[model samples]
Every structure is written in C-alpha cells, then in structure tokens.
Target: MKKTVTALIGLSLLVSCGNKNQAPLFADVALADEKQTSDWLAYGRTHNERRYSPATDINTNNVADLKVDWFIELPNDVGLVSTPLVVNGVMYFTGTMNIIRAVDATNGSLIWEYDPKVVEEVKGKRKIGWAHSRGISFYEGRIFAATWDGRLIAIDAGTGAEIWSVRTYDMERSLYITGAPKAFKGKVLIGNGGTENGPTRGWVTAYEADTGEEAWKFYIVPGNPADGFENAAMEMAAETWTGDWWKHGGGGNAWHGFTYDAELDMLYIGTGNGSPWNQKIRSPGGGDNLFLSCIVALNPDTGEYVWHYQTTPGDTWDYTSNMDIILADLNIEGEERKAILHAPKNGFFYVIDRKTGKLISAEPYVETTWASHIDMKTGRPVEVEGSRYEDGPADITPSPWGAHNWQAMSYNPQTGLVYIPTHHLSTNFSDEGIDLENWQAREFTGGLGVRRKFSDKQPREYSASLQAWDPVKQEVAWYLPQETFWNAGTLTTAGNLVFQGRSDGKFLAYEASTGEILWEFDAGLGISAPPITYTINGRQYISLLVGFGGGFAGLGADAAELGWSYGIHSRRLISFSLEGSAEMAALPPPYFPEPLNDPNFTINDEMAARGAIVYTSCGVCHGSGLIAGGMAPDLRASALVLNKEAFSSIVRDGILAGRGMPGQPEITERELEDLRHYVRQRAMETSTSDRTGSTNNPRKEVESH
Candidate 1:
C-alpha cells in the first residue's frame, strides 16, 4: 500500500537536529564536505559537482540483487527530470510547474508538499518554457527552487512553507528558469534560458538565502556602451565584440553547469551561445565573442570575473558551454593540477585548469566535423573552412542538441574516469533565404539567424552511448551503445558501479571501470533525470525520477515513437536497495497515438500556411512539423481540433492551464482557426488508409537534431 499525505505537515523529525545536539541541516561545511555520503546535499552532491558517492555498501558484486524499495506516483506532473536532494533522510524534488515535495528517504512516504502555482502567477501570458526543472538546492533549513516563470523561492524544510520568493526576470520578457538553483555559503544563485526565443541578454543572479534580496548579478554578455559597462569585466568584454551586438542581447545565458569550488573559493560558470546562434548576425565583425561558450571563473561573493577559457570562440553552431563543470585534481604532465572536465555540445571533451581557466587537454569525444582540433597553445578550436555555413548550407556533426547536453555526467575519483552520457547527431545549418543585413529578432519567437534544413529524402543517422572517459589520458576507456538518444544522466559510485536510465524505460547498473551491465530493471517509462544514491539507517539506496520530456524528447519525433505518449504512463520517483522486495505495478503497454481522421471537415491550405508560422509557439511543446513528441498531446491525433470551440476553449481560454497546458490569450481567433486547420492538414497528410484516410499521404519532414 502507498503512504502519502496530500496536505503539508510539520514534521520535526525530518530536520537534521537530533535532540538539539547535532550540527544544523545543510550547513556550509556540511554541503562542502565530500566525505559525507549519507545524504545528497547539493545538485552534484558536493560543490565539486562530480556526482560521485564514496559509499560502497551496494557494490558491483551485489548490484544484481537491487530491487524496487518504493515508488511515488506523480499523476499531475509531466516531465520528471529534476534530481532529488536528500537532506537528513528527507528527499526533496521539484516537479511540473515547480511543485516541491518532501518524501521519506527510508520509505516512500510524503512529508510535506509546496506548490509555487507558476501558471496562476504567469497569468497565461507566457506560453513557452516550463517543462521541468533540473533540480532544487538545500542550505541550512531551507530548500531552494526555481519556477518555470522565473521565480526563485525558498521553503522551510521542516514544514514546506514558503519563506521568501523573488522574481528573477521581468514578466514581459521571454525568460524562464529550468536549471536548478545553486546554493552555497549563505546565498542561492539562478539563471534563465530563452536564448532562442527572444533577444535575451543572458544573466545569472545571486540572492541572499535567508532574505529574497538580490546580492550580485552577472550578465553573461556585455550590454550597450551607451548604457555604460556594469564593471571593468563588461568593458573588457566589449572590446572583443563588433557592431551593435548588444541590440541582439548577446546571448551567453548560463542555464546549467554551475560549480562552486570550496577548496579554491571560486565559482565556475559554463556560459551559453550567442543570442541568435549566428555570430555572423549577432557579431558581424567576427570577433571572438567574449564569454560566449566559455568556462568563466568568477568570485562567488562579488560575482566578479576572474578568468575564462572559451571552448568555441566565435561560436555560430549553437555550441554552448552549458554542460556540467566537474572539478577534480588531475596529474597532468607529471604535475598535480586542479582540472575542469567538460563535454559540451560541440563534441569535444575539455580538461581545463580550474585555478586559472587554462586548457590542459581537449579531444573529440564524438565525430566532430566543425573543428579539426583544439590548438594546444592557444586553447581555441581550429574551425574547418565553410563549417560555419559561411559559403552555403553545411552538414555539421554533433548538432545543436549537442554531443553532451545538460545531462549530468559523474566522475569517479576511484576509477580515474568521467562517465558521460554521449550522443551522435548532426544538422544541416543554412542561412540561404534569410535577409542577412536586415534580419531582426521577433519577440517570443525563435531568433536563430540560421535555419536548420529539413527534408524527407535525407536519411538521419543518430546514436547514443555511455562513455567512460579518462581526463588524464584524454580518451574513452570504455563505452556502451544505447538503443536511443537522449538517455538519462549518469551516477557513479565508489562501489565500482555506474547507474543510468534509458529512454526505452530500462534502468541499468554497470561496472564503473569495465562497461559491464551487472543489473537492469524495466521502469516502464522514459527517464530523463539523473539517478542519485544516498544511505539511511546504514542501507544504501539508489533513486531515480522516471519520466521523459525534455528539449530533445519534445522536439524529436523519433523519440516519441518509443511509445511514451503524453499522459499514457505514470511519472514516478522510484528507489531501490539490495534488501528491497516491494513490487512495482505494471504500466500500460507502449502507446502510439493514431492520427484522428475528420471526414466531414475540410482543411484550408491557405489557413494552414499562415498557421505554420503561428505553430512555432505551439511547437515549443508540441513537436515541429505538427508531430507531437510525447511532451504534449499530438494535435494530429486529438479530436479537439475537429471542433473550433473546443480547440479555442483549451488553447485561448486558459481552461486547461491547471493541467500543464498554458493558454495563449494573445492568439487571435483567426490564428486559432489557422492552427486548427494546420493540425487537420497534418493529420490528413499522415493518416493511414485503415484509419479512414489516404494511404498516399506522405509523412511530414522533421528537423534533424
């Protein structure tokens, strides 16, 4: 039987205080201690962001005995991608619309629940973003979380009551928060993602943990000189940029990969790509855009720039350095040096000196065609001629989806290897028809200066693998090919094991050093979140959030074919232990939505053409080319599109906003009709003969990742 509480309850036992004799829960020293393995205090377990545990009770030898200990069903949640933070045996995680839940780590029992009510707060104005949060943070007695509507909130850990809340961005702008709030010292930090949706000048803010007061803010890109530089760092950054780059909101949003070095007393931020993604349009003079796609070290207290190492200088291929920044001590050239292990979207695995932001070694972990290699002396990628689509359309390896996206990679200090969830994909980038000189960014719409070419005739090749890379040797030690792309993040343990969940709903444990699968479990749902391990009562437990719906899963139609259609399977937070005997309920069989046919209704081709432009907003959740990728309901298969009133009530009336569907009050009635017609056209084109439709209808071409 399941044990759950719907209402928030005050539980004194959940706090770290025991008889008023113990140190406070999540103190600065406690969060920084790498030796503590009983609880996961931070996103990366520790400030180092290695995602490795020293606990060894569940070693590779006995990993096969692992079974489900407990699980909590999340029926209302969509994407279960947030990492659960364990504090003194109480697990806290953020779900859809930033709902925070506290559950018993020993047994899956709810302690308290906190809802931020993001939809009601946004008032249906914002339509995009708001899929899932990467995680939450813990400092002292507070749990910190960032909402989809760009608000950072703190809740009392004992009672789940809101302590303080602050908006991180302007409501009018196209900014949203999906990354976890990094808490360190007495402050919590957050950043927003909207580089493609608007003219966003990406930035990160640090706020006082106890109070909602802003402490320090760092803009990833330099703003206009007419407004004056914020500091000398912005002035120094301006020298490397040409043209009115600030007008495009020079995008270097640090959406993920934030690490704080307790030993070095410094902060490392993995910055993002240009606003429009086309440097030719954002930075016409072709100067290396300062801090875009870079590992920038800064003073955590002051938010002051220290040093940076640009991975993709003059980046135009959406190669953001927003991947995980793992801090470790490496013996390079027979000398001990602090290093940052990073595998970004560009397909290159970087090992840089964390102290000075200097490149130690860099190598291609995947098939990299944009750059031949990273220059050892200059630490810059050697770009191949025409790779940037300078002459025309060019097929590039390691597409914008990245060789390694925001998925967390774990580093095992015991094995001297970094376990990375790697993938291989390519995109054909072109600016063929866009007016280069007169291009302008549209509000809340994709501002990518370059267009990704899509064709039904072209065959797309893609694959994923779990790779064990040696930072010291700059090579892959072992690799296991996955069945599909966009696999979940990895977790490594000193127990000589690596745990990762797949999009196919299978969770596996492997020998950390040998790439041998020792155990597997069918989760019955796609998992996009990383698994975390912690111990309570001397029993080590492995836990994972099992649900799929992230960037790639939402956009790629092939991913939707895995049978994890929207709302078909239950989202869950599942845990396992060697002593676990609890059985998991079997999920419904894999479901593939059949396109609904409307014999009575006629599709307006003219309206469909206009609706295609408007579909861009809907495509943020619904798939591109009208194919739903399991994130939202596949409109082609929904009967609601057959009626104009039903479609408008859900799309423009905000009636279903409570169910993760945001209303677009801005969409006019004509646009709504056009959208309905467009979806019907796609349904007719993709419907099969047996489904009361034409057999000759060709499949819609989708954008290659």
Candidate 2:
C-alpha cells in the first residue's frame, strides 16, 4: 500500500509541498552551518563529515587553470558512482539504476530526471547486487531517494515531483535498500543490505520528515525470540546469542554509513556482517556477535540505544562497521577532544569517544594479517587466531575489501589530516559447508558459509593509496601510490586542495598541505564517486561522478585486465572551474567483445556444482569466478556463451532487459542450465589456459575479501 510515484514539473513544486518541515528550507541549521556558503549540504558536505570545502574560488594558485565546467552524458553504461547534492544552484545526482537527477549547478543544466523505476522498482522482489543509490536526501523542499527496492523516495526538489514514499523494508524479508538517504530533524535515515547472501537481519529506520510515517527502528541484530522483540535493544541483543543464532538471519545490517550529530542529538549508525559469514556457522557459541561490527549511538528521537563501538568482535571476516563516520574536533592532549573518525572494515583506524563510546585510538592503516593489534584494553581485536577461518584457509589482511570500503574519508581541520582512500587488498578466508536449515540469499555470499578469496582477482598487483592520516598523531602523514584499485572518494578544499579520482582516468589535484601533484584530468571514464564543492554566481566549482559501476561488481576480469574498463564510454556529470572552457566528448573507439566459445560446452562436476549454486547469486554482475569484479562482459571473452540462443534470449527472455541485462525469472531451467555450465566451465578454463601454455591449472578469482 505504499507506492507513491510522482514526477511533477513545478508550480513552485506544488507550493513547496504545502510548506513541509515548516520551510526555512534545507534542515538542521543548513547542515551544521560552517557559515554555509554556496550549498553542498549534508552527506558529509558538513555536519562534520568534513569533506571540507568552505569554498575558495579555485585556490592553490588557480588549481592549474581548472577548465571543463560542464558535461552531462549520463544515460549510464552501469557506473557513475553518485555524490552530488548542491542546493540553491541545483545539482542533486545518482544515476545507473537508482536514477534520480536534476543538474544545473551553475552551467550543467538538465533539471529533472527522477526514474525510481528502480529496475522496474523490483516488483517481484528476489534480487541481489547490482546495487546503486549512494547519494540523495534534502529536507524542506523534499527529495529523499534510497531505492534498490526497499523504497523511501519523496522527490519534488523543484519539480521532479512525487513527494512521499515509504516501503523501507521487507522485500520478502530478505531486505534491500542500498543506503543513501539521511535527512535531518524532521527525520528520514535508512539502512539495509542482504546479510551476506540470505536469511538476513539488520536494521536502521526512522521516517517522518513530513509524513512517510514510521519514526523509529534501530535493530542491528538479534531477532526471533519466537518472533517478537523490537525493544530492550532486542533484549540486550539476545545475550550475544548462541546456537540457532536466529537460524542465519543474525547479520548486523546497518548497510551504509549514516551520520547526524547536529551537536550530539546523536544518530551515528554503522554495522553489518555475519549472516553465515561463518562465525562457526553464524554464531555457534560466540558472543561479541551482539552488534556484528558495531558503532551504535542512536536516539535520533526514540530509536534509543545510545552507545556502542564494537568494530569487528567475533564477526568472522566480513568485518564491517559499515565504514564512513567522520565527525571531528581533535586537538587531543591540549584538550578539545570529541572525535569519532572511524575507517572500519576491520583494518582498524578508529579514534572513538564521541561522548562515551570510548576507545580513543585503534591504529593499523593497512598491510594487516588481521589483528596484530587493536586492544586498547578491552576495546578488543588482539585475537588474530587464524582470523576466524579457525586454523584453516587464512590469507587475510585488510581484505574483506576493507582496510576501508565505501571510500569517503576526508577530515582536514586545516590539515590536521585524515584523507584515506586505501587499498592494498588481501583475502583467502575459508569455510564452506553450510545448511543452516537451507538458508539462502545471493551473489557470492561466500557460497554460503563464507569463502572470500580475493587479492584483487589474483595475478596480483593491487595498491591504491591516498593516506595522510595523523588523526592527532595516530601517524602516517603521507602516501600517494597507485597501480590502481578502484579510486575516487576524497576531496578537501578551502583551496589548499586534495581532490581525487583514478582507476586510470586521472582527475587528481593534491597538495592539501603536502602530497603535491597539483592538477590532472584524463577523466575518460572510471571514477568511483566522492568529489564535491559548490558556489554559483560567486564562481568556484569542482564537481564529480564520472563513471565506473557500483561496488565495482567485484572487479571481475580485473575490469578489462586493469585499464579499469567500462568501455564504450558514457557516464558523466563532470565540472571544473577557473578558466571554464568545457570540452570532453571524445571516447568512442574501444570495444573488445569476442567470447562466445564452446569447445563443446559440457562441464560436469555436476555441472560445476550446479554452477556453484547458480553463481551464488549471479556472480555479482559477472566475473566472480574467473575473477573480474567489474566492467561486465568477459565471460572468457563472451560470444554470448558461444551462442546458446543468445544466451537463452538474454537469460530467459527479457531480452537484455533494456540493455542492463535484467531478466531472470529467478533462474530455473535446471538453474539456467547450471549457469551455462558454470560460465562455460570458466570459459573453457580461461580458454584452455591460454591455448596450452598452461601454467598449472589457473583461473578462479573474484568475490569476497
């Protein structure tokens, strides 16, 4: 009963939706007012996410004549990691499948695009991965977003219409909603992500903000006390649980970083990992499983539970204190305090103490072998014991795609440091053999029972840096390296600069108090979100959201063996400043598509173990078994699986579901012929190990860690 799709075009947007949130416009004192200049509002633009940017008319000696200044392109080729949101001069954002647009931040134009057609709004449910929706939310004149099929919409920021939505959760109770909606005061917040491929559990609600109702949620984990218990914080998270840990749904899903501190009215959120992440089959006898990888502190008006800080305690390797927390104050010994900082994904870097969650330090920026540290007395994590593979397959180290995931770390209180953007990757975890009453979900949920295995699709060489730390001398004041590992996410300004973006399409801009670089721009495509700055009639620009596809589809086939593909371009939103100029439109000329092999497609081992449980949730957008986390298409050089009726008319008939390949009648036809015999038996074992020069049986890289 909650499907309010609307797309109006401006009658002053129905008089500002009958003046909701009592109009003074964008809430929470214009997002924690850093003397609010030329918008950028919330989502870390301020409220201390410290993405910095008090705007300085393109400083640092004219940032090398900045240039560009206008570009649009977006009709997505599946990747343009969002992060826009400027007010007054317009902006907003979010593309590839969580749709929502509304450009014109002073010269870009395009004012209204909405489409919560969120993949046909997932009407029939049962979906996984291809997740996108990493930005949106504005108060007063509306615009909330959050889709991926769990709803939360609201539209109307100057006429993209709608104005109310609410589905929030319960997609057949497997939960979804790729976070990105965090309004303030009048409420809004959201959170959820399939608990490691099935039988889930996780929470984060809080609706209202002018009538989408609800108003409170906060469940992190601890359910099924015979199906009742939404209070006493799930009765003290059901005493850190024991066996039958709610039979697989014990995952702590607070999906993606949420923040709001308008001066300690709190609401910090962050938690995820553990539904079959193999804590001995989901909490066999473990304890600290309470809030999976904690970081609580709620009470944004009634979702109570006011304090937590876990950070991977008994959470078996999918380590996720859901990244990004920021909120600073520092000064340390000379007194000022207040911190919070984070960096999660279990490769450490905490700093805590935001009014009593304690810990004031945690360390290890990366190169970990899983915990050789982090015991700030009782704050835990000195237990590196086979890193939860318990005496087995443990090649671990900052690699649950975490030595920080969900990139977005920038603090700079005038260079007091923080910058981040890490990546040295690692993974090898093991534990497959599950059956918890047949629990399930999808996409490499470590084939259920946590397997992992990623050191960036093997033939190794990962390393993406940007460091700078010093969160009050917790160290590292430098770093810039990179041979590539999904870049983009970090922007510091007030003119001493520090922008980012590279997966080999440059976009640089360094020197926020030493790291140098100065200026760059290649931007032919691949950029993974995060980069913002605003200013209109008074000048200054610097936008971003280039293109690279979400959570990097597990970097399969190393997205074109490392040029970070996404080829056949198109995914922009660009922008720059100082000498304006604008130009771009020049890509068209790279298209590799040639795999359609079959050297007689037969592949048995029970059809590659039923195509590894039908690609354990569709190899997260192709390439999690021959390793290619992203840039789709590369099934051993695809020729549409050597033409099985155009791969069964694009997976059982939706005919390339309008090009994004959508159509999977929840797959069955003997599970799509055992997922085309496990991707044509790993593309004929990667094309007969490259035509016989085989180096001892290779190929199998992608998914987890």
Candidate 3:
C-alpha cells in the first residue's frame, strides 16, 4: 500500500571493481588506500553493507564497563539509522531531515551542522516521505549524501558545508533519495525507488565521484516489454511475469541497503517486489521474475547483471528481497569459503556461495509457514498453497513487516554470528489487481490489501527481540527479547559483548555468547538507530540515535491490525563509554494510559491549523489527501466525510479493535472541532464524488468541486 520512492543513500568508501552496465558519468574512486587506519567511514563499514567493525580494542573483558557519556535529542521522528563516523577526535553523523552534525566524540557536544536545503513543501506535506538523511559518506575530507528529495550532495566533512550538489533523479516524478551515497572507485553507486508506486522502470545509477555527473544506470526491472529496453534479457524477464503486466510496471526495485565484495569485484544489490503486488497483475502464469526480489551480482563498472538468485519468485506476498547481504568467509559443509549472508524479508536466512551465487544452505530463523523449505535440489522455494495469494486472504506469517525489516544486522567474525534485530508479525493480504481503467491520479497508487495479526503477536505485545544467528549451525544461538517494537542495531566488540538499545529507552550491553544481560542504562527515548563504536583521542566511544517513530510503529502502517501501539514517539542521539558513570537506576516501564474516548471533541480554526501540522505524523503512510495505503482511511472519501462522528470515534478509539489505534489523550473540544474542520476542508478540496476509475492512474488528480 506504500508508494515506492528511491531512498538509496551512500557512505564513505572506494570501489575495487567496476560494473559493465553502469553509465560513464559515475566516478571510480579508490577507497581504503591512504586513509585506512582506524575510522568508521562508510555505512555498514564497507560498501558490502556488512555492519561489522574490525577494531578489537574494546574487547569482551572491558565491555561491561560501558556507560553513558552524553546524549542529545533531535526534533524529528524519522528513524535515526545513521552510524557515527569518527576521524581523529571529532564525530560526524546526521541529525533529522538531512541535518548533518559534527560532535566532539570526547563529550557529546555539537561541533557543527550542515543543513541541505530541502523543499519546504516536501518537508511539511503529509506524503513528503519523512524527509530524512540516514547517514553520510566521506571521501577526501568531503561528506557525500543522497537527499530525501533525490539529490546527491557533497559537503565538507570538516566544516559541514556544501561543496557540490546534483539532482540525480526527477523529484517532480516523486523520485526521492533516502540512500546513503556510496563512494567507490571514483563512482558514486546508488539505487532508485518508485517501483512500488507503479513506475515501470527503476535503476541503480552511478555518478562521477568528483563531478556529480551521471555515469551509468542499470535498470533493475526492464522497461515496458513491447516498447521497453527491447533486448534478450528484457524479453526473457518479461516471460517471468504474467498478465498485461506492462501497464503495471514490473516493480523489483533496489530500495534497501546493498553491499560490495571487493575481492570478487562484484556489486551485490537486493531487489524489491513487483509493482502492483498482485501476482495476477504481474505475470499471471508465474516464472522467476528475474531480478525482482533477487540479489543480482553486477559489474560495478558496467551496471550489467552478472548472476541473481530470486528470493521470492512470482512475489505476490510483498516479500521484498531488500535485506542487507553481508559478505563473509565461513566454514560451511566442512569447508571455509566466501559466502554472502542474507536474511531477507522472506523469513529465511540464506548463506550463498559468493563466487558463484549458488545457495550453500538456507534455514528458517523465525516462525515461517510460507515456503515448505528451500529445496536443496533446485535452490528454489517449495511454497505452500496457503503462502500464495491466488485464493482470497492468504494467511502468511511474518507479514511483510518481515521477521527482519530494514534494521541493520551486525556480523561478528569472531562469533561467526550475525546479530539481527528482528520482529515476528503477520498480515492477511487480499490481492486485488488495479482496474487500470478506474485508477485515480492521486499518489496512493498501490493495490488494495488488508494486514492482519499473526498468532505470535506476543513478542510485540511486550517487546521485539535481538537475536544472534549462527549461520553455520543454521539456528539461533541466543536471543534477548525486548519489550519494545523497534531496537537500535547491534554492535559487537572484541570483548565478546554486543551493544543494542530498546525502544523503551534502555541501552544495554549483553554477553554476545550467553545473551546474558551484562550492563544497562536508560537513554530517555526508544533507540531505533544503529550504534557505532569508535575511539576518539584514544578513548573508545559508543553512539546511537535515540528516536521513537519511523518503521511500523511510527508509520502506523499495519500497527493496529498488527497489534502495535501508534504514537509513542521521540528522536534523539545517545553516546556512551566506560569513563562515564551510570546515573539512573533501572525502573519498570511506565504504564501507558488507556486510549481516551472523547466523542464531544470538535474543531476551530487555530486548532485546525495546528492539526494540519500534526497530520505530518500520519503522512508517512497516508498521502496529503489523507489517502494512504487504504490501511488508513481516506478522510476525503465518502466513507469518512459522510460519517464524521464515526471518523472521530475511529481516530479517537480506532476501528481495527485488535490493532492498537488508541485515541489521543484528552484534546479540548475546540481542538477536536479544529481537527474535524481542517480534515473536512481537506476532504472537500480533494474528494472523489464519482468513483468511475482506478486510483493507481497517475493522471487523474483528485478535485472535490
């Protein structure tokens, strides 16, 4: 139900190999040459997106002494996924809304801030896609970033000032930039989004490192079959899809984080789901959708598809293959070999041979009922009948929220364990292909589907979990479940300690081997960001962005139906070390007040204006017209306006009873009236009186009059 936008951002690094399909404009800078000592430069450490660090200074013995040094709260709810990059004694990281800040790593103090001017409308609008900057890439003292609105920017890392900027994609067409711009071999490799929103074509392009010029673009999904990039690959890929799928635009996008294996010189990219999501609309007969939902090995220089293994072929369940593929060499089948480890949204942990892209062994790390098992024979999934949405509501466990979402995972080579922050949730999806003739022009252009609750909703009932998976054993070695929905990512040290924070405002260090609680502290708000460990002035410091919101809870995507609380929100950055003293004592989580039911509420002008601003909170899922993924009711529709009281009740108490849509705290009647009036005005301005067309059509702008 969410529209796709290119959110690929990059981080600091240099490339060892070049892709063939890449254009000529991207740079080919060499990373790790001169400046390779003790710095956390890029996202996931290297371009391979393996969030693992090689430093062993703070080993398991001293890790228990970790304590809070200092922290600061940001003003936005966008998930703080940034990893701090420390060079010398200063720390460079991103604040909310592409806000880059430099802080003194010795003491959590602000050094400087870089604010890339984002469009005002894109900042405040409901559908403006949570204007966020994940993290930045550093090269030659310059920091590079892909903006929230589709621009590749370079700022002086030392001064936090802009050096150069370029609009990489057409923002007018809704192409947004959320990826951390990766610098490798003089070229900036980046992937685009919009396939989820129904765009027929999506690609990963590289820009010249020094010049920000378009270098190359490798289309993840071929263009329209008939008039698309008419080639053998396109024609072959077309066969994998069904229906008049050209109109739907095959939507396998590379929207999540990706990785690169310098040893192999192959760039690995994880693809997304088909555009309409309904298999019948894609390729009805069903074949391997080539690169869609697959990890494709591409020539970093040419942008050519080398080899791919589709995670979810004929993807009808929105099981995007957009997981971070960590590169590692492990002893598997009694042989130590190079392998790419993937824990995709499909609920499986896959360890594939890196050299050949062949599956070594796969295992289910969660409660999965989709595929019976990964056939060792063909390396394909033997999907169960109930897994596909061919029939009505298929009861798929680990609903596309996934056993693992975008939360980054850390691979500790020492433990040979992948530390993942994962969730267990499910959704019931009823696939209804877009009636192209009846589609509307508004932004909410995805198909219709309802999310349901998975039986194991218990984990989320109290908290999510941090799991340590042993790929060799294909089993969970240890897990520490939290009473929070989201968790900051894991950071492991030579000390045999793993560091992670809970959404309930607690940051703790656990024994990596035993999963035993070793140390803990409260960071004020939930920590949804990944933590980084770096030494400043010979002192090792640990940092994490402490924020509540973003992801399932903040967006309220399928929150209620999925039994997630809606609006327990805040954003901040917290850093720690052994030198600081632990101040606060451990306390029980606060008791949340029951949802209020204030039916007497009504709206006034001033309150309406303020309410309009608050609506940004709802915009992550719902578009500007209050028309989102249909997960949230469209206020402009007849169903909402015709029953204002019912709308108010639903807002206040929630309609999906099991889904945690509790009403807000007591708002004055005047505030309620203002909210009602503002929504009513918005509805009148964008209502569709006659339902004669499909909402997926991009041409029909909604006008109430």
Highest lDDT among the candidates is held by which one? 1
lDDT of 1 by residue, 41-86 (tens): 8999988888999999999889999988888778888887889999
lDDT (10s digit) by residue, model 2, range 1-705 = 010112222212122325432222778877888756688877778666788876777878879889887766664446666678887777777776677767557665565676767656553344555556678878877779887768888887877768788887655555666668788889988887877666677888899988899987878888878878878877887888787777667788886888888897888888888886777766777788778788888888888897898877777877888888988888788988888998887777889988889998887887677778877779887876667776667788777667778878888778788888887667787764445445444442434475666543432354567888888788788887776666778988777788988765678898888888988988766678888888878888888877776665444555544334444566667778885876666655334344456656667778777777767556666656644444465666666766767887677664655345556656667877777777777766665343221111112345442
Root-mean-square deviation (CA) per prediction = 3.1, 23.5, 10.7
TM-score between model 3 and native: 0.77
In model 1, residue pairs whose N, Cα or C atoms come closer than 3 Å (at least 3 residues apart or on different chains), thus clashing, are none
Model 2 alpha-carbon drift over 4 Å, by segment? 1-31, 38-42, 48-67, 70-194, 197-219, 222-243, 246-249, 270-304, 307-531, 551-573, 576-579, 589-592, 598-614, 623-633, 636-677, 681-705
Superposition-based RMSD of candidate 2 using all C-alpha atoms, in angstroms: 23.5
**TM-scores of all models?**
0.96, 0.34, 0.77
lDDT of 3 by residue, 246-334 (tens): 65566776666667677788888888877656665566677776668888887878676678888888777678877778888898778
Where does candidate 1 stray beyond 4 Å?
A: 1-13, 19-23, 454-462, 689-705
> How badly does each model clash, as a count of residue pairs?
0, 22, 82
Full ranking by TM-score: 1, 3, 2
Show model 3 residue runs off by greater than 4 Å.
1-37, 73-78, 121-127, 194-200, 228-232, 432-444, 448-463, 555-570, 581-705
lDDT of 3 at 330: 94
